[model samples]
Target: MVFLIQKSQNKDSKAIHLKLSEIIASHQGTSNRMVNIEDLTELELDQLRKFYVQLSKLAAKEDA
Candidate 1:
């Protein structure tokens, strides 16, 4: 999954995946974890989507 995501042309997706990788890598136990995408609030999800859209535009410009 990480390999596929890291290959993404969209910088936001790549960056988000990297951050997720770091969070998983730093985990110490099976029961305890800090990164929880499922627990994100609606506002946070909206913000994340906005960021992705912004980055996607930048990616398109770069491609052009």
Candidate 2:
């Protein structure tokens, strides 16, 4: 149903937002390269997917 689809998308967005926050937190004082959203290319994005998976696994483990 449309509601389910909307809920799924919302969940995904929240996951992405949480993962992004963690990623930023992890690099808070490091010299790690940070890019602006407008500067991201497709390849940079593909690489960033790894962080999301890692963050989600971490979150799942914490919940369990």
Candidate 3:
């Protein structure tokens, strides 16, 4: 757990996966989790598009 946290301090993003069978067998959740970037719904995709647009504008403001 400490090693994972230390590793992530330098990266933009990290994805973690935990197997369902392992969790079921152990009766405990894995310390790793991830968002499936490929599985975004249409609405979520649109929201992300809008967010990048807004983020770009904010970045431009710093230059202006």
Tell me the TM-score of each prediction against the true structure. 0.46, 0.42, 0.43
In the range 1-64, model 3's lDDT, one tens digit per residue, is 9887675542322111112322332435542322353354445545654655576687689889
For candidate 2, write residues 1-64 as lDDT tens digits: 9998886676565545545655655754532344343245545554666666687688789999
lDDT for every model?
A: 0.53, 0.58, 0.43
Stretches of candidate 3 above 4 Å error? Answer: 1-35
Cα deviation at 55, candidate 2, in Å, is 16
Q: Is 2 or 3 the stronger prediction by lDDT?
A: 2
RMSD after Cα superposition, model 2: 7.5
The lDDT-based order of candidates, best leading, equals 2, 1, 3
Clashing pairs in 1: none
Q: Judged by lDDT against the true structure, how good is candidate 3?
A: 0.43
Residue runs of model 2 more than 4 Å from their true location after superposition? 28-64
9 in model 2: Cα distance from truth in Å?
Answer: 0.2
> Residue 50's C-alpha lDDT in candidate 3?
64
Point to the candidate with the largest lDDT: 2
Clashes of 1: 0
